[model samples]
Every structure is written in structure tokens, then in C-alpha cells.
Target: MYIEQLKNKKYSLGSYIPIPLGFILLMFFNFLMSDGVDTNEVIQQTISMIGVNLTFVVLVGPLAFGLLLVLFWVKFVQGQTLRSLTTSRAKVDWKRIFFSFFLWGTITTAMILVLYYTQPENFVWNFKPEKFFIFLILAIILVPMQTSFEEYLFRAHMMQGIGLATNSRLIPLIVTSVLFGLMHIANPEVGKIGYIIMVYYIGTGFFLGIMTLMDEGLELALGFHAANNLVGALLLTADWTAFQTNSIFKDLSEPSAGFDVLTPVFVIFPILLFIFSKVYNWKNWKEKLTGKLIVTNEIDTVANDSKL
Candidate 1:
């Protein structure tokens, strides 16, 4: 039903191409141009030059613009309401968003604390009140924009686009999940921990995609993502990570692509999915995720006039 919201004739492939294609090309070129350069060194140098907060703005600000772009395209080009782009419900569900955010935020913070207590030597107290508060403000403001841009692009927009074209939920789920993973190929984590980290990234995409399909809304995905990035930014910073922020702690451990990488995808994510499924009362696994989409004429008309 969420994907069927895009079944209107106004939702043309040409309309969908430019924004996502431009984003993918930008990432590809950034990866290509940074091929031989030491990305960590570059990040360090940039942080040194501009400080952590400004460097974060430099890195993440465009994604806010990207979020605006996606919303604009959905409204003007596709002639759809923001609600339709986000969910099939009568309105956007703020309660679901907040629930998912609080749930994941607590889990992530607890996990970080467990690690901090378990391996005290690997972490340093790097919390500077002045710098941290500044970074916190920026993280609170910009991090959601960055995460929301990704969710809207990969989970909502591209997922619906691919589903509209193929009429099969499984194809879009797999394609978007893989594309979402490949989009992060240039992250410093990949360079630090090797390509095996891709399993986590791709698996995260699958997790989020499955969540979107099962929940029939982006609220859970959006909230979970925002909380994950925001909490990570506030709590920890590592040289090998993408967001090397002025956080409460700094990781000094050697990066490894070991059990940590596999655990999330293989263990924790399935558990989280189970929790979300139970909380949301999700059903019809065979149809919501992998079955053929059947959009009646009435659904198409309603989708078309959603802007009215």
C-alpha cells in the first residue's frame, strides 16, 4: 500500500531519475577522486583546519539540501503530498516516529555504555563542554536531515520507483538495499575495516528496507536512523569513522572487520526486527515484502489526487 501510493500516472520514471541519479553520481565521483588519497588524513586535516563542528557542517550540510530537493520533487514534479511520499496513512505518524527513535536511541546508548565499561582502555574521555555542546547542537539539527535524506532517497523514493516499474516488492527491496550499501563504499569505515564492512552496510539497508515494507511507512526507518546517527555522534568518535565528531569518548582501539561487523547484521538486526514486528503487529509477510503489487484503478486515482 505504501508503494502503491506511487502508482499514479504522474509518477514517471523521468521524474524520478534526476535527484537519485545525481546523488549516486556525486558519490561515485567522490569515491573515484579520493581513490588513492588517505581519507582519514584528509578528514583529520579538515577538522584541524575548520574545527569539528564546521567540518561536520561541511560534510553533512549538502544532505539537508538533498532532503529539501527530494521533498520538492515529490511535491512539485510528482504532484504528491508529503504525507503520501512518507506513508499510506491519512497523516504522518509522529508517535511511531518518536517511539522508534526512543527505542533505538536507548539501545544504542546502552550498547555504547556496555562497551565503555567492558573495554575501558580502548576509550578516552574526550568530552569538552564547549566543543561538545556546539557539536551536539549541530548534530541535533543536521544529523536528522542527513539520515532523512538517505531514508527518503533509498527507502521511500527509490523503493517506490523500482516497485512501480517492476510491480514486485522483492526486487526493489533487494536493489535498494544493495544500492544503499554500495553508496557507502567510500565511507572511512570501509577503508579502515576492509570491504567486509559492506555486509553491515548492506545488511542495514536490508533491515531498513524490510522495516519500511513491513510497517508500510517511513516513520520507523526515519526515527531509527536519526537516533542511530545522532546518538553515535554524541557518544563516540573514532578516527576510522565517518563522523569524527567532538563526542563524549574517543575510540583508540584498532579497527577490525570481525565479529562486530557480522553481529549486527546476523544477530542484533534480526532481534530488532522481531521487536519491531511485535510492537507494530506486522502481518502478511509473504505479501507485504515479496509478493506482487496489485494497484487498482481507484487506488491510482486516489494517489493521483493526493495533492488536492
Candidate 2:
């Protein structure tokens, strides 16, 4: 029944036609906003970029996306249900959320510790009580917003629309994952690692997409992303990192796009993925990822034909 419902809401060819155009519009607006900002140096400019990301996060709700799909259904095709729009019918599983949160938090903490061991000098013993508390508070409020916006856009909104349109799991999974990576092209890490880092970003997208599809909801992705960002922002701050917000430990290390990007992509993420797969008992990987999307006429038929 859920699969049938998913099929009913799939988008048409014209459904995502606006996505790229929308990005272009958003970029233009961001450039205009940045024109007069007070960022003078490279570090300042990077902070300014973070500010831009924050602005986008504020504009887009934690689950703001999928509206495009709803619009497509209403304007292009007829008979989309409210459940499809609100995702109310598919219950949000909190257990998945907590599990993802714990899993990512542990993995990320381990990664940070490993990094610290390799380059202790890069970290300035910055465990000041006052600053640490401030970082904690900000994480409590803002970090989740940033992570949620990303998950909602790429993992939730875009994935749902494309899934419905293609009537298949794999196409949407691949497309949304790549787009998610592409969106990060301007990240500071990109400049450091060349395009090779994109593999990691896209890989992460694939990982989250799989979690969402198999789990039958966005709770896992949402929780994982939120926990990842929240911890990253609160636990550490580096001059070279994308988010330089007040953090507990300031990384003074010269930032290079080396093992940092690759390790997470290659080692940490895969381990986490395996852990999740085992914990959730996710099966039929090939089928769930590559399966075709099908939109049934049953729901619509029942509603309309009932009147006859």
C-alpha cells in the first residue's frame, strides 16, 4: 500500500525542470547579498559563506522541500493526496532517529580523536569554560538547523520528487546524491582537495539516500545529519573549516584536503553504513536502490470512481 501510494505521487518530466533554475536563482541572490558584506580576508570570506548557508537554512524549513513535488502533483497531475504532501501517513520513527544520532556521533568523535592524535599541534588547548558553554548552546540551537536544511533538501525533498517521477528507487537515489555533492562544490574543502573529494560527498549522499529509502522515511538521515553537524560545530572549530562558529576546540592546523575528506568517505562512512544496515536489518540493497517507481491509479480511481 505504501509503495502504491509512493507511485501515485511520482513527478512527471516537467516536475524537476525548475530545480536547476531555482539553484541559479538562489546563487544569484546569494551573490547579491554577499556584495556588500564586511568580510575582508580569506577567513572572513569563508565565514561570510557560512553566513550565506545559514541564511538558506533559515529560509528553508528543516523539511521544507517536497513542496516542489506537491506543486507538481497539483499543477501538472491531479489527485495527489494530503498524506503525500505532509508525509503524515508515514509515521516518523524516532527509534531510527536516535540510532542514527548515536551511530554518527560515535564515528565522528572517533575521527576527531584520530585527527587530534596525528596533529596535536594543530589544536590549541582551547577548552575554555565560557567559550565551550557558548558553543554548546549554539549547537543546541543552530547546528541542527543547518544539518536539517541539508537533509530536507537533498535527502528528503529532492529524493521524494525524483523517486515519484522516475517511479524507481535507483535513479532518484543517484541523481539526488550527485546533486547533493554538486551543491557543495563551493565548500572550502573542495578548493583543498580538488574534485576527488566529491566522491566522498556524493558517497555520503548515496549513504543517506539508502538509509532514507530503506527506512521508509527521512528520520534516520535527518538524525544522522543533525548529529553530525551539531557535533562538528560544537566540539571543534578550525580556521580552515567551512563553519568557523564559536567552538570548544579551535583547530589551528593548516587545513589541507587530505586524509580528512578521504578517511570519512572511505572508512568512517562505510563502517557507519554497515552498522546501520545490521541494526535496521536493511535488505535487498540492489532492489531498494535500483527498483523502478510505479504510480498506481488505484487511490485516485477509488476516490473519483466512487462519485460515479
Best by TM-score: 1
- lDDT of each candidate versus the true structure: 0.87, 0.62
Ten consecutive residues with minimal summed lDDT in candidate 1? 299-308
Candidate 2 local lDDT, 156-238, one digit each (tens): 55666676666677887898888778766655555555668888789889888877776556667878988888777766776
lDDT of 1 by residue, 1-308 (tens): 68886665566777777887888899899989989887888999999898888989998999877899999989887887888778877778788889889999999999989989999999999999999998888888999999999999999889988888889999999999999999889888888898999999999999999999888889889999999999989999998888999999999998766665898899988999898887777788889899998777665222211220
In model 2, state the lDDT of residue 249.
69
**lDDT at 233, model 2:** 71
Query: Any runs in candidate 1 off by more than 4 Å, and if so which?
Result: 297-308
Candidate 2 yields a Cα-based lDDT of 0.62
- Model 1: how far is 209 from its true place, Å? 0.3
